[model samples]
Target: MRKWTGGMLILALATVLFLSYNFIGKEPHKQTAYDFFHPSNTSLAMGSSSHAKSQQRIREKPHLIDVQGLDDLYLSLNMSEEESRSLLVWAQMRPLLSRSDALPDTVEGIKEAATAWKELLSVVSDTRNISDDDPGWKDCPHTVTSFNGNLSSNGNILHIPCGLIEDSSITVIGIPDAKQGSFQIQLQSSQVLGEAIPNVILNYAVHLPGDNVTDEPAVIQNTWSNDLGWGKEEICPDHRSNHSIKVDGFVKCNALVIRSSTEVNVNVSHPVNHQSTNNISVGSGHMSVNFPFVEGNAFTATLWAGVEGFHMTVNGRHETSFAYREKFEPWMVNDVKLEGGLQLMSALAKGLPYSGYLTSVLDIEHLKAPPVLKKRILMFIGVFSTGNNFERRMALRRSWMQYDAVRSGNVAVRFFIGLHKNLQVNLELWKEAQAFGDIQLMPFVDYYSLLSLKTISICIMGTKILSAKYVMKTDDDAFVRIDVIISNLKGMVPDGLLYGLISFESSPQRENDNKWYISSEEWAHDSYPPWAHGPGYIISRDIAKFIVQGHQQRDLQFFKLEDVAVGIWVEQFKKQGRKVQYISDEKFYNAGCETNYTLAHYQNPRMVLCLWETLQKEHEPNCCE
Candidate 1:
């Protein structure tokens, strides 16, 4: 009886011991306020994620830190360290115009703030051209990004999804600290400016040390949601508050805790409830400056940690630096934490300076072009039309487009249409599409703002499916000198093809009443990259492929203006080491046709008839002259 009892006791003890070991060692799964948006704080979920895929490559995010008081930093760096520090202080505080007495809350003050922001942005944007020695100078790789964050590992490399990472906020990337000197990270922010108000902080727990100082980070990232105003209680808990006072929900403090590097914008905001602490002591590093923030502006911020401290630059401007808070250690910091509104486009944790390349195959549209055809000077004219614009479509077909050659197997001409909200209009468009087979209607509405999307579909059809050597995107109101254009196509090269009235460095219209009012929300940049004027532009097959691929990768930001969007693609290709040969000659007139005209814009039916008849009578003279 005693022996049996003893055996039972031992077994029970063993079972209890096993249970205790498992229970005591594991951490509980707790969701905090920060975790709702920032999943990077948690263990990386190995399988499928509920979040949508990542949309950026290493460099699509543009726009960087505000250059407030860096006047001498540019024109001349001859200023003393005291002068430099003073300027830096002023630059840091300019964005806090919402709070500072220097910037009173009034229309004049707001206008002044806006102007200051514009000037600061100008410095950051143009600094690269100033000199290689200037901080923040970087050559934009400027290609489309295709790796949406849904990743799969194939033993050797990790594969991501096939869309843009538009919705993702934090992308926590862990870097292997193999060497002590390893400390360089380069990434481009997406071009989408999240909120019109530039009040937010994009915090980076730059050097997340895996040390004995509690694994829980000292601060949660301030993901000031547009829905939630900037409130101090959540982002920087009471335990985290130090310098800036929280007015309403906006949190402001002028101090630094040297944990890492990332741009933090001080803008109008919202709130949350949390604890705070002020245990760490670091002096003189204050937060200031807010520049015009635009989403989808591809800005690059590169952080390099040296033996002294963390040195940083944004798009080639030497932005800021921070010395070691505690001390630099190889085994200390291993991962990067990105918090806030940014679509974390690229994260490079390589401590050593290294090079990497991105190659993508992005195509998403189908056109029923001839599968097999002998080599010919083929060209397709995709005229953007509307359901209500039936008159315009018929007028075009009966006028200049009536050329029998356009109906040939070698050259395909089609009208691209979009659905109207009215069912009758939609049904009529579908019927038209089925009957003519020349009308390609899309699933989207026929709104003028979404022309860029329509253009994407056309390029896909022209380049990937049609196999055309040349394609032209013209408006329904334009008349093309097709007979002359074909003659010129014979001598054109197979690549680097672009022909249009080029627009160079056009300024964004700030006047709201104007048809072209480009709010900072739409595009934050002062001037746009040189783009071809929209009414008509000729693209070679290769250029078409590049443009569509870039858009698919979400590298090309979609603007309301279709021509400007295409121009953005052209600029991106230029950054990618490809060049578009644009013919800015007045003969490729953006307005009504000149006597020597390859194309005529805003042509009515009468104008089209006149143009076709006149060109034919000219004995095939060079219209390009």
Candidate 2:
């Protein structure tokens, strides 16, 4: 009996030991805020042993001190310890990892940074294996063409469901408010969220005579975009010029206004020439007919999209025709806004093309399959994007990604996006990621303040994964001509090339209200290092590797401005006795589109499609028509 009891005890002990080793003694499954959005195919689960080894290696280093400022930075970001450490391990300081004072000096801090670095690498490394298969196509439903409405008051807005096209015409019947000095009719594109102002495709203003008796009425026409601000004004009937208005192929005033009769006692002071007096029509002959637009005038104006530009006919007479600017294409105008002194009675738009008619030629749905990275790439373009910018991403895919370089896998492009605050958006983004296979999901909440992390992510992708000869960082709203850029890069030296619209002397914005604001606490310098504009910039593979390795070794510096941060890194690389060629070319347009631009920034989705179409048809660099 004693032997049997002992045997039972040993069996129970052995069973308990096996259970403990299998479950209890092992690590718990880690949960992240983004786990629900992350697909199982990707590496959401962490590898503890790898992180442990990394932490051990970091802890072995001496002369490490605790960085309290970095702790505060992590707090300010409102990220968990793991995320904060991951960011620090990715890039030190707020933006770069170059500040020795900001480096983790203590064993605990070092381990945190190192562990975070390993986790980030593990998550983003999966981007290389993303499926490149094309998602099957789906047909789009029909869309509206014409819009009509009345502008009842100042600042009244009307929607054009389908933007304008050739032969599209808009007619407005309104009376100018006499008390107001000026009124404006504007054609506006769809407003984007982050843009400070909506793009104005056309700005038509009519200024009435001032209080001064010598003042004359004026008419002006122009175009405006958020990036370019405003184009040259096409003013009519200059007060200094002949009363007969002439603006070569643009403006001609043939308006007739009945002059107001004011009785003036002649007193017979001088004998007025009978012939001259007869020259004046039936009454007091001061005809206010030179300017087409006037105060208190009930006028019917029709504006139509024509071959060259937009033509305006006021009261059945052609008043003006404004030449088309580079990027303000007729189809880009999505809505009309009426402002100022006009009381609009009715508005009507006709002959507008159906929504898909203009863009159907793109055949975005039936686009070619996404290119697989089979060989070494000449360039890897990492676009910084947000989770909800679905249209923008699709536009890029349909437009520039169709280039031969990208189609042949000589160039690779991927969007780096972080998790969205909204779960629905995250789900959609995940679906998009699965469908496109061109997006790399960063494991963090997306914010403008965290954009520097995206820059680091780009370098990580370009060097650690795709192994491209050059890495270029650009925005989703930009249009990049891959072939042109590649041709530009051909003659250049391969190593340490930093190419873009370079800014040689730019001061750091100190005011808190500025968009690119940097507090003295963040950067104690007066001017930023020579850096390329953020809209588009390129660096050689070696520089990209230095950025990646610098973060891994805890030596790179951090700056809030990504472009300026890159400049800081390149400066550090130069300090290491390496040569860096800073190629500042104007062809990389930092603002809106220009003639023969290599890359144009702030282009809307429609404009992107238009640019691509123009490039293909013309076989040259041309702005969107």
- Tens-digit lDDT track for model 1 on 346-414? 553332210111012121012222223545437767888755454456556655665655645567677
Model 2, 572-610: lDDT tens digits are: 777676899999999888768899888998787789999
The segments of candidate 1 whose C-alpha lies over 4 angstroms from its true place after superposition are 1-377, 614-625
**Which candidate gets the maximum lDDT versus the true structure?**
2
What is the lDDT of every predicted structure here? 0.45, 0.63
TM-score of each: 0.40, 0.47
Ten contiguous residues minimizing lDDT sum, candidate 2: 272-281
Q: Please report, as a residue range, the 10-residue window in candidate 1 with the lowest summed lDDT.
A: 352-361
